[model samples]
Target: MPKRILEMTAIEVARLREDGDHSVGGVSGLYLQIIGASRCWMLRYTHLGKRKRMGLGIYPTISLAVARDSARAAAALVQTGIDPKRAREDEREAARMHDAKQLTFKQAGEAFIKEHEPGWKNLKHIDQWKNTLATYAYPKIGKLLLSQIDQAYVLQVISPIWSTKTETASRMRGRIEQILDWATVHGHRSGVNPARWRGQLEYLLPNPDKVAPIEHHEAVPYEDLPQVYKQLCAIKGQAARALRFVIFTAGRSGEVRGMKWQEVDLFRAVWTIPGERMKSGREHRVVLPPQAVEFLRNQPRRKDREDLVFPSPRGTFLSDSTLSKLMRDHKINGVPHGFRSTFRDWAGETTHHPRDAIELCIAHVIDNKTEAAYRRGDMIKKRVAIMKDWADYATSETTNPA
Candidate 1:
């Protein structure tokens, strides 16, 4: 017969100093195993006539009361004809899977941007996303789980600035909605997008158009163009030349700044801006006047691929503020963009030319589908006369009106 073991007291368990194993025999196969001064609880049980040992936890770290409870639970599993060791392994695997699937809102937004940024045309667009999200969305719920970001939290991000900075806040809402949609598609999250505007946020927030007042850029008067043009011409630099070209062509500042030598056809006196550069995503053909062509020819524009016609001091693309800073330095009371409006006003008030040709010259999107289609021809011959007249009027300071 085997000798019956006595259940050890708390004082006896505390007195244990020697290494090896000590059994407190109220429960079968429960031991306080001490090895080289470290102590822990282990359950030595038999399943299917095979001895199996399972660790409960460390002594003093996991209190003896908790260890006893854990051992009894493992013992109960054995009484139910189940293996507690396999159960514990299954639990650990489940925890690993849960951790692997977790995604924070910042992580998801970054992943979404990385996946889609290659397809975007403007490099500044990525900066826009980073700046807006970092300033607004990331603060409120960036570290929160994707499943945790509900519409209430999204509203918290946009509502404070929605009325004050309506356009920016509106754009932020759209971006957040897009990120959530991407999350859903990739299986990181599941639900109708909380940031969605039409059926959700639109009802909560006031329409941006109704709340925000329209503010147009301050434009130079038509009669003031000669004076502005003279000052721009007198300022000698790439930024000055870029400004003059913008005013002369009525093109966007970005289009003028991003111009490569390859895009200009001086022999034909035409500059073709590719679809990717134009805001309308269509190629724009600008008829260069003799003076305009002459200005460009004097630029030492070598026929080299990717050579910018107007590069910054470092030979990279000029910053957006380059022309504005020139305007400020000369104390010119108008902005670079304001020059486009100056051209538009001049075209409207000073010319007898048809409106369609002028709008097409500035690359404005025509409202009438039929008119827009006819603009495919873009009235090039008529535009040459108009642009020449504009160039002559702009440069002369006192040219007779055509």
Candidate 2:
């Protein structure tokens, strides 16, 4: 048993500030430690043959009376074989967990976004996350505690939109699941994620693909493409000319719209689209036919806007809707993008082009892992022949008699 020092008054304890541990104690091993003008209450004790120290509280926030009481209680626990420091740590961790449980869904979501935003590559994706959460989730479950968010709350946000806006609803459910998963990992919540899609949400909601069958872009039939191409050439303006270029290359509208003069090599008859501009995140080379190379050579140079090959009137990249509007005005049945499908249909139905070369013309991702691993080359030489046939067919007045 440790000896108890004589109990001192508050005034005596305050006066003994010689920068060392002083027992101004009513309890054994209770101390008022002073070092370099810093004063704190420390309880010094032994448990199971090991000496230990525990910070009771800081003074003058914790007075002498309160310090003695804390020390006495801690010493009692020490006598019962409990390490006082470990007991204090356990209590504090429990309190922290309880506090974390009270965090609202919105708070947790914002924290998750903030933590991950730096690593995210796309700004549009970030905007979509913020927009969807604010529009659907915030009104429903944002204010609810993170730990309290269950299947019922997730269903409330997703059910109303599931059948009507299946795509958005599916994405929102995924985002909610990720946020909840992040919270669980950080100890803010527990249990299976209610927004998870597999065995959980699968039973709760209808399958997304079944609810909203994919509607492919409206494409002009291959037989009707010759007439459509003739009408497109008759129309004047940069947008019309750009549409012609799209038909010649069978490239995406965004890819054509954002095409730069630097990317085009008229001498070599090739267009090299940088990975950043391409959807696949890999650089792609487009084989330009003689007609397409001639068209490029004839294009007027804009000295002030030298970088872009197809800059809009304001000298910026053309809006996505620009070509679509041109088609609408000309009473064209299909979208500008649907031209790729037109080319694919024509080549598959009429020509002897290989399926792989035709698909690569439009930059479609190779799905088969084994095939993708083996096929490293872009087959630019094969596509050169394919593009020539496409351009000749597009410009010729004679339609396929078959």
Clashes of each: 0, 0
- Rate residue 373 of model 1 by lDDT: 74
Per-residue lDDT for 88-116 in model 2, tens only? Answer: 89999999879856789999889989999
Instruction: Estimate candidate 1's alpha-carbon lDDT, on a 0 to 1 scale.
Output: 0.85
**lDDT of candidate 1 over 1-402, digit per residue (tens):** 222256766667878888888886667788899998799999999898999999888887876677778888999999999999999999999989877767999998899899998767787888999899999999999999998989899999999999899989999999999999998888788979999999888899998888896668778897888888887766678898898888778888999999988898989999999998987778999988888887887785544445999887777888878788888888888888898898888889989988888888898877798867765577899889889888887887734211
- The model with the greatest lDDT is 2
The superposed Cα distance between candidate 2 and the true structure at residue 103, in angstroms, equals 6.6
Query: Per-model C-alpha lDDT, please?
Result: 0.85, 0.87
> Clashes in model 1: which pairs?
none
